[model samples]
Target: MADVKSKASVLLVGGGSVGAIAALNLETGKQAAVTIVCRSNFNAVSQNGYNIKSCDHGKINNWKPTKVLNAIPKASEGSTFDYIVCVTKNVPDVPPSLSDLIRPAVVPGKTVIVLIQNGLNIEKPLIAAYPQNIVLSGVSLIGANEPSPGHIDQDFPDTLFIGAFANPNLSPQTQKAAAEDFVSRYSAGGKTQCSLDTRVDWTRWRKLVYNSCLNSICAITDLDTGRIRLADDAVAHLVRPAMLEIVAAAKAAGHELPATVVDDMIEMDPLDMYLPPSMLSDTRKGNFIEYENILGEPLREGEKLGVPMPTLRVLYYLCQAIQWKNKELRGLVSIPPKGNYVT
Candidate 1:
């Protein structure tokens, strides 16, 4: 048995639906003291705690971690965290880069950085920024969202797979041990399923087949997953082809997924599910969707690998327009006069 007396200090950034559930579990086992950064709902969470309606854990009322704050504390606070887990969206094109957001808590070689996010090659930037630190990558499949502040609705249970990102500065053995330790601590709650994955990149590629297709398509059409599936030939004409393109690109990049993966992803949801993906929810809320992370990165990879991704290219162009509109609405970007681009 592991030493239960030795408790690790964990700082979890992003207290949205996914982050809340992760924080809940991280503290449930008493293995780690968790401090969550809730940027949007700090007051609500601090006052009343999170109200989670989970299928796995049942109705969890007024669940609070060890600490909750609106922002990360500065380094001058004199507290170095053992693990900094970031469940925030990876929108590199957006302002407030991930590195800058988590820089305050990083303790050189001691603090491990863990990212549970979507998209391909999301670990590269962190690995570059923290060369001497161990970086862990997590991929999760859970249906969860915050319909209102401090309230989480989770229809699917949390099942997270974590692995160490490849880093030249740290030995593979060291990175793997750190990842395994996190998996153990994260699963201590016994409600969630957390496991260590050796082939994490391949796992990500497998997920991309679904994320690159349905996630983008649902957001573009403004339709829920069920309605998209019920549309006329939407699965055959749009979804499957796009998934095939992603699978081909993954193969070119040295990850060979199964041929039936497309079909499997398509059938995963029921026709009446009516669940909106994270990207679609962002679109509905007028927030900037992760177009660059989810689509642009994969499209660029496909181009570099010489893989033909025509369907994905179309989706990428459409998502770019949507993201641009979102930025314009929020005044985060400006458009020049119509005549400014005269040929």
Candidate 2:
């Protein structure tokens, strides 16, 4: 049986930008007991704590978790949390996948696996691992970066879209319960948490529309979003075409991604031109990029569905080359960066 406590227990597994921002927001009203797994940066985080500068959740100079661990701690041996958020990057090639990271804190069939990372069709592995566990996801539009240890910069849209995974085997009531529980803990401030389209699956596909363009374009060319499009007619010849391929692929896979997304992304101001994307930043900094989960999986899906994504295929191959170079340069096999999107 589940303990019906008013206060929830949340175990955040990554101390990256999204992880810090999530910790700051979810712990409002101290509604939930938040424990952060800092991994390698545990020493820095334990002493300094999180230094957050946000456009939404205004400057929290020192936001410390109830507990921090260098790895999945034994403290979770007999304990289970209401929410287990994996803000860590979803690199399937990596060992101890997300499924393994949440093991210690999980209560078997009861805990909710909240994946706050980027990627499409990412919830499948968790859904397969914990068939009964309610899996929820969030697409964070906010721009967040880790400039240094225990420090995070959260700039941009003060909103995040979250809801239950699109799965027929799951019960809507159960999913909503999990969503509402998170909302209850997350709605302390003016932060916007939207549940659009009555289904959360579309949100992931929608973000891909922009990410596929900007993330790849910026990473390959080593330029910001605006600069990439502004150079050598890149927007017309490269970015726009790749985005169109994604739109077509999504449609063929039975997901409707609006065609207007291309124009909307192109026209984004400030706002749009500056700040390189997470993937782009990671590549430039020689950090491990989420090539497989973010780009590879989506392209494979398009191929499986018979959707011809020649542009996306090319983009994937390019990103993969960079990924290989980074790995070879660093002598690494499988491990996400300490901060998921930290560059």
Candidate 3:
């Protein structure tokens, strides 16, 4: 494997909050030749650059990358990338389709794609699109949001865990080395830590359990993390049952995720942490909620695996209905007679 530091090209799809933060961090560390592709027009980002404000790091203004493309356009005809980082939401009903943009960058044995979104089911579509490309899954505990175009606000700086998909033929040493290099590069000027865990699937499932319990519920109730943390009754009454369903779904999917993961999740007090979830921010801004990828996917998979996930099913449907209702009230879109939970 080539040294990550020696690499000259990197493509970052989805210039949302997380993507912008990652790009700024990567640029600060001088990691590879970085290019950020955004759905918004180039003139907008080019004029103002990116403003990244973090609780840990003071506001950064005009943090620009090597290149910013409005969209992924055939990879510049012959351009290739060493690493492709995808930080887009996987809500199927959302605009700016991420999978279609990323498909052009997945060349096997040449490009490695790292998914840093808040979902558990991005792998299926990614693999179907580029089976031979080295696909890695990861979970970020960091809290981030976009206050405006070309601006990202990171509330909580947290750890990142990354590893290749389960495969007997994967080279562990190569994966570890790559992960370490990525961490070192991104964390050079920051305090974040990235670890290489072979148990990538378990880690992802653990995060899924967390998201399943927190994101949508907070969005639906319009509660902040601090409120949820202080409310133990809410955890036991609502969160725990949903977590149980998520655990059952993970187990049925052949991943043995421990129940203690949920306990650890609830142990995070939002007041002490002083961070809000992206779902809450999305709801406040009237953006689409990523209900399907986090909650709906698990519920669907659970049914297929013969696992009972009633709590998750109900929560998923409720979130969809709520989002649909919001859209209808706002006159954003006409709600379909049969509500679809794709987003």
Ten-residue region with minimum lDDT total, candidate 3: 1-10
Return the top candidate by TM-score: 1
Tell me, by lDDT, which candidate is best: 1
Of 1 and 3, the candidate ahead on TM-score is 1
Overall lDDT per candidate, in order of appearance: 0.88, 0.77, 0.73
- Comparison by lDDT, 1 against 3, better one: 1
Q: Tens digit of lDDT per residue, candidate 2, span 172-211? A: 8888778776766766544645343355667777788777
lDDT of 3 by residue, 267-334 (tens): 66456764557777778877778888888877888899999887787789988987787668767687
Q: Against the true structure, what is each candidate's TM-score?
A: 0.96, 0.89, 0.83
Candidate 2 off by > 4 Å? 1-5, 167-169, 194-197, 269-273, 332-343
Clashes of each: 0, 1, 0
